[model samples]
Target: MISGALGAAIVATLAILYGRALFTPPSEIDGEPLVAGAARVLYVIDGDTLQIEQQQPTGVVRRRVRLIGIDTPELGRTDAPLKAATADQPFAREAAELLRQLTAEREVRLELDRRRRDRYGRSLAYLYVDKRLVQEELLRRGLAVVDAFPGDSASMAKRLEIAEQDARKHQRGQWQKQ
Candidate 1:
């Protein structure tokens, strides 16, 4: 049985993706109605951010989601002024592009931690595609660093730390010297 919070979240997501129709039978374009913890990727916002589509009772809803447990350098997001204060680092554009290549237009499963949203109101989640974790991929490739401020569990932080360390040692992506 699904928990109440999770059930509500699922309904909310469906409403967001599908619109007021709410589970109006899966159409040809959309494979099926998504239950809780799943959504379709609309686009990649940055290395750690994504825009996802969910079905709603009224219509499809699109939302911005931020990846938990990792922090990649910036590409000057207009909506995030504080982020723009920092200088763009190595591989910033490449990191975002890689994330786009990996997740754009794909369906993903989201795993939430104890906390769901960030102070900035972006949904925090661990996204998976084709059984692979996107956060882990970024870390292993050195496109992102382990920064667990948004994560509730320490295990994710520890795992990301190890992965980032490995990427650094191997001179992966952003870890390489210019």
Candidate 2:
């Protein structure tokens, strides 16, 4: 077995080499404060939701982020909000699959909008993987619908609408039935 001191030294060296990579600030993504609200995506709950962990002065904070301005088909649960079967929505699994591929085990940057939280208190924000906006990509792929919530800004709403239109014209994702 390795000596205790030697093991500890190895761990310390690894931490020193990899610490910043693990706890990257949002601004470090592609530079600029525009990458603010950086966090590690712990996991994805659905196409439009993620569990993210961010460091704060007090400690690390973990919260669910809801991608605003777009809505994917519901993945209903027996005890969920007005619980019912959501499997009926076309491309429901496909959307969730795509979301998982995009966000699982990745670090993401959050850009908050006019509203910061949803009805369930989930952080309402746009997610960026690398420097690419996740919301706009989802809309472009036709995996999401522009379900504008009351708190969503007019400008963002318009942009989502335009993306949806493009997706529709191209017969992408939901626009094309399986």
Candidate 3:
């Protein structure tokens, strides 16, 4: 009986240790430093996110990146006019398609500001393609709305505000009249 009790204690201790290791926070790991500069887009996840590949000590690392300062409407969100009217095709689908056409397998530059990976482990980056900012493109095309997060750099914030103004004035993409 004593041996069984001892074994159970050992098992409990081991379980606790293993659980702690498995759920270790990012702050605990010596996370890869925030990388900036140029990279190539391997794929586009949506209007505001893409997967980019960059060189690292362990060969090339691919990062799933979410664009800062933009939030596109959901594919079937009731707030989306296009989705409300069309039962067949949703605006989110169209935006994703557009992003794929623009960024898939293309070279882009990335700029990192405050945080690196979001809670979900996706890298948060400001992307540029063909000398134009990707966030601006989404806004200009009316695919996404400007939604700046805290800790954004001054210049980037200004640029995003300008892009949003442009989109609003022109009523591009989803901003267009119904």
Please report the candidate that would top TM-score against the real structure. Answer: 2
Q: Give candidate 2 regions above 4 Å deviation.
A: 1-36, 78-88
Worst 10 residues of 1 by lDDT: 26-35
Cα-based lDDT for every prediction: 0.78, 0.77, 0.75
TM-scores vs. true structure, each candidate? 0.70, 0.71, 0.70
Report the C-alpha lDDT of model 1 over 59-102, residue by residue, as the tens digit: 66566788988888887545665554555677888889878888
Clashing residue pairs in candidate 2, if any? none
Model 1: lDDT of residue 50: 86
- Point to the candidate with the largest lDDT: 1
lDDT (tens digit, per residue) of candidate 3 on 1-178: 4698899999999999889878754323435554787788877766677777786664566667888878776554355666554332345776788778777677878888887767787788888777888788887877888787777787788887888788889988877888
Cα error of candidate 3 at position 33, Å: 4.4
Write the residue-wise lDDT of candidate 2 on 43-132 in tens digits.
878788877787655456667778988998766555556656445377667777787888778878888887776788777888888888
